[model samples]
Target: MAEQPETIKAFVKLGEFLGDYCQFAKGNLEFNEDQIKWLHKLDDLVARAASHNGWFTQGNILYAFEQWSTALKTDNLKKWLDQYDIQNSNPMTVAIIMAGNIPLVGFHDFLSVLVTGNKALVKLSSNDKILLPFFTEYLTTLEPLLLGYIKFSDEILTDYDAVIATGSNNTARYFEYYFGKKPNIIRKNRNSVAIIHGDETPETLSLLGEDIFRYYGLGCRSVSKIMVPRGYDFDNFYKAVYSFKDIIDENKYANNYDYNKAVYLMSEFKFLDNGFLLLKEDAGYASPIASLFYQYYDSKEYLDETLKRDADKIQCIVSSRPRRDHIAFGDSQKPALWDYADGVDTVEFLLKISNNN
Candidate 1:
């Protein structure tokens, strides 16, 4: 295998190629109009695959590509590469246990492995098998070197240098038991939450809709619950989010929301109303359906404490506060290239493989 520095350069070139692919995919780069249209057609194919497999809608797929492009141009990927020492590592094998909550959710793991010259044996979620194969096929065309390194299997995998697994809280216990013997990055289901100060603009509130409803709210990064000031009006927020009502028809999601809503209302639960949403004064972070819902609190201090108490179950926290880089309300599933999932630094993980350390 090549030396570390040489390997890093190769990975950097691959990153650049992937970045270019995104532009081509988005029709934002210069190309024959026909070619651009064809590229977008490919995007549609992937979107259809996602929908058929119960992954997400077409809009969410486009949003995911947008975030991927942004991260490619930004310092995220470069920073990850440098921080992880991608160029100097040894040839390693990486086993990836992927998630199906959002479009291309497995892409980051693929990028990390290929850039660092590690072979990837991927166990694709039953809900997400379609898109990853299409993506890998296209990537192979772009860089023939990767054709053999990326393999998909349904069987249990072992004897790998490192492992990255994503699953629900219950499944995580099984992952830890099975894969924990190796250098592993195991992820459990964690909900994202948003904090509202009762002063958000309509546009901001509308964007929050994207955070909560996108992917039909299946992603770990999706904002499952919200924290709003006590007595906050639901009318303004509902009006802003109602525009997306057309996209909320995932039967599984609607059923969940509706079922929960009926239970709350029949039980005579106390909830604040904005005509379109319900704000129940609950203690937990997960929300029930039949409501564009949130848990109301009297103070930010209490919200902070609640979050802290459930830190292990929480992932990204969205806030308008300037200090936090939390994703906007609807941008949770649309992660940048460097936004490593499950809080694990993927590039650094790849570097360990490169160095055989």
Candidate 2:
């Protein structure tokens, strides 16, 4: 109960606004004088973001908004923060380096810094430059006190006590070399995978399509590969995912599909094709867009051991098994507030550094 109620209240109010925006986002929203202009501005932002980044489609942006709307509820916030004993700490500047693969991928880090009574100095990915600043504006409108706590930087980061950076394997090395001296959480690339047994129903396979295709498989949580039992029938899997074949209608995605298909053909690598998608028999976990790599497993025991051994490279396991840690199929994109990326707790990291300072 030591947590500030006003901060929580501000986020809850912002969540209500987002929910309303998602419901009647096409200029039909009802709001007071203060929020009316902001709502209009947000509508403009959706258009601008889509135009700025070809991968950030309007549907994906709206989906991100709706997901954040549901995640920012009072009850969910309380439950997520309940595990920690929050105490007053000297305010320090925490620099955040965000990723742009999917929409608003860095909001969690921004929220973690500000909610834990620290200032956030964010260096946004060029690919996702607009959404977070607009969100910060909305939060400051709700809680004027937060006006000083959030900042966006276009220059080299400086004057921060700690850093939280997310990027691919290459940038992670750079982050480590530069921010290693500071208290930091540097994240590298990790992809998700799914396990399939022969007995899955069509509904289960179809639902898995959402996991693979949402945000065009740009998210780290998206299933890039699958592990199936020996003699698995892919005809059923292809049929289940046929409904999403229209994904090739998008120009960027179709381009990638075509490019990758040509490369595979030129290399003379064998892969299965369904016009819109290519399935390859490979051992790697990270598959390119419009392509899925799969590996065959002979036994459940060996598959479990292999997954456990390579857990660090994996983000989430989508499976029908009752393992406590596995994410159920189709739920990978809908992570709860407590599902920390790379399994490293952000709140705890912030609190530890804050108390030390």
Q: Which candidate is the best by TM-score?
A: 2
C-alpha lDDT values of all predictions: 0.69, 0.90
Regions of model 2 farther than 4 Å from truth: 2-4, 26-34
- Tens digits of per-residue lDDT, candidate 2, 71-184, equal 999888998988887775589899999999999999899888877888999999999999888888778877899988888899999999999999999999999999999999
**Can you write out model 1's per-residue Cα lDDT over 1-357, one digit (the tens) per residue?**
223333334444444544555676556677677556546666677667766865466556656666665565435556556554345335688899998767777778877777677889999877777766866766676567777788888987965788888887888999899887788888887778888888888888888887777766667777768788887787877787888776546666566656766777899997765433456666565665435447778876897788788887777888765345466655666565666666678777667545656
Runs with alpha carbons beyond 4 Å of true place in candidate 1: 1-44, 47-51, 74-76, 248-252, 266-268, 271-279, 288-293, 328-330, 353-357
Candidate 2's displacement at residue 242, Å, is 1.1
Candidate 2 RMSD to the real structure = 1.4
lDDT for position 162 in model 1:
86
The TM-score of predicted model 2 comes to 0.97
Candidate 1 lands at a TM-score of: 0.82
